[model samples]
Target: MKAVLIEADTISSAWSQLIYEIYKNGEEHKPDYSMSTRRLHATVAINDVDNNQINSFVPFGENLIKKYKEELTEEYAEWYISLPDDDKRKFDYCYAKQLFRYGETAYNTLSENLKNLRVGSRRHVGVLWENEVHIPKFEDQPCWIAYKLELLNETDVLLYILYRSWDAYGGFPANLPAIVEGFKKVFREKKLPYRIESLIATGWDTHIYESDLQAVEKIFKIAQLCPKCGNLTPKHALISTTKGKVCTQCKCRM
Candidate 1:
């Protein structure tokens, strides 16, 4: 698998660059349990979490982010308990459910740790997957496995997340901002002085599905990297004609 690293000032740029890199260099992977995809191991670091911008290229918007944020922070134990037994078994896992009401006793990993935060607590982390429960399943498993909050300085904290598998195109846009919002809410409620300095996300099997390839290409058609200079040229700077597209930066024909 190809391993790629991206550092950006905002989430939009990081996600855009990630898609471009995967489109350029990702290898085709066919897993028996899921759909075939163009996959890469991606690690993205966003320097400014507060400046996370939603990309207009994708269909995702603010409403989706808000919904995901609520799902991440809110507890749904009562709803789950009200469901029928068969339905409960069918709906095996939810990220919020696992993080807040995990196991039979409904242990709240995130709130419990935040409630007990000390002056120098730097290892506050949340678990979303239990090995004993999810190891046997090949499908319907959680992509987001865990997250950690580490103190970077006296007034800044870094949010680091890990995913066993991720859908770069569909999931990356909304999921990231929602998680950040959820964390921020808790930190504020706890009266913590630390602000989230940055966010680092690692996706072991980061991929774009085969079905979304054309859509991804369409979104980036107006803007593409120059073949010679390898710099992403703006749409207005590119010269498109009946013959082919030309890069104004390096004058490379595509």
Candidate 2:
């Protein structure tokens, strides 16, 4: 499998390029573990973590993005406390639970790591998967596996994330922003002086599922020509609204 590398100034751009590259270059494959998909191995670097919104022609909207981010930043225990015992055990492996509450005591991995960094502990990595917990499961396993924070030159912090698998069409837009929000929450709480320099994400199986092929086609069709500017642009570079579609460059509405 060829590894594709994408470097963009924002998450929106990275996701846009990623989906287009997969649509253009990926090969169709049926994995034993999951649904058939057009798959690629990809590494994406977003230079500005703050510019993480998906202002594109994707299916989902900001509400879904906000929910995903809340799952990362909010405390799982607080939410879990309201759930019945059976319900809690059945839905045990959300990103929130794994991230904010891992292991027997529900150790807060992000908080612990931030605290370590504050006191000058060299460890900045957080593990989201446990072999004992996740290895036996074929379903409900986390696509996201781990994350690391790298402090560079005492000025900026770069976040590196790893995913066992990623759904390029349905998952990428929401996931990236959520991860960045999670880290920003920690940085703010810890009162870290460093800015988030970039976000580097690697996915072993970055893919668009067969079910989403039609939607991908629609996105490409919409991107072919800006209705207002009449210039060719990718869908990610344009913003769609109920009133009209707007070109990012010319800001013309149609």
Candidate 3:
């Protein structure tokens, strides 16, 4: 069967209820559930995100965590550290997939020379970090990695990218402009000619958040809906969009 979309009309309605159960009920006072690690457990039904399925279970998982250790790679066992109570549920699913192929095929592609890289025999790991975004444009339901990296100079850099799945139902808008710029800077500073060779867009849930469903539709109205047909137009697909348009698909001048 072909992929279908999740129909989330009133998506944000559950947020308030979710917060109440975790805070007011003192879930910490309750006994443990099976293999469950989150401080809060509330099952939510989200319709039409993955497929045209009428209903699907959505769990609440969000947290703020800090990893202070020094290691470019981490064992799965390293998850025992403490995090903000809210983040546990979110991390569990985002991390627990068994069968996975990913956009980060470059996982080990960081030059081996860079690993033990040093300025005059001192060790350095080029790194960066960022969390707790203001305005949080993606509705915050989307999944991705956030982190800070320390340079050879002991200076920390901030990085926020939709690393794993760039095409989830909603993805970050503000994060991209900064990342493209950062991509240019890092390679230039390192004096490397390599470009971001492989940027794989996985899944199709990538979208910016809006307060209500109509606001979400309004974006489609501006981006994809053709004024002539009121139908989602092919001229609006990713490549057709540009700084100034001559549509890539139809070659129609904007």
Report lDDT per candidate: 0.78, 0.78, 0.28
Q: List the residue pairs that clash in candidate 1.
A: none
Tens-digit lDDT track for model 3 on 1-254? Answer: 11222212222222222222222332222223322111232232222111221111112112111121111122221332223548644343222111011122313222333445333442322211123332354443224343222232332222222243232112222223223334434446567543432221122222222222344344345444223212233344434344533324334534
Per-residue lDDT for 1-254 in model 2, tens only? Answer: 76899877777777778888888899899988767999899999888778535745656988998888887765644586457768835475678777788766779887777655533334688888899988998777889999887776566787889999899888988898888887788678778776778889999999999989888887788685445533336767777766566667656423
Task: State which candidate has the highest TM-score.
Answer: 2
TM-score of 3: 0.29
lDDT of 1 by residue, 72-171 (tens): 7754444655567778354757776777777667887777766655545666888788887889976778889998877766778788899999999989
Tell me which of candidates 1 and 2 scores higher on TM-score: 2
Candidate 3: list runs displaced more than 4 Å.
Answer: 1-143, 146-171, 203-212, 222-254
Q: Is candidate 1 or candidate 3 better by lDDT?
A: 1
Residue 162 of model 2, lDDT score: 96
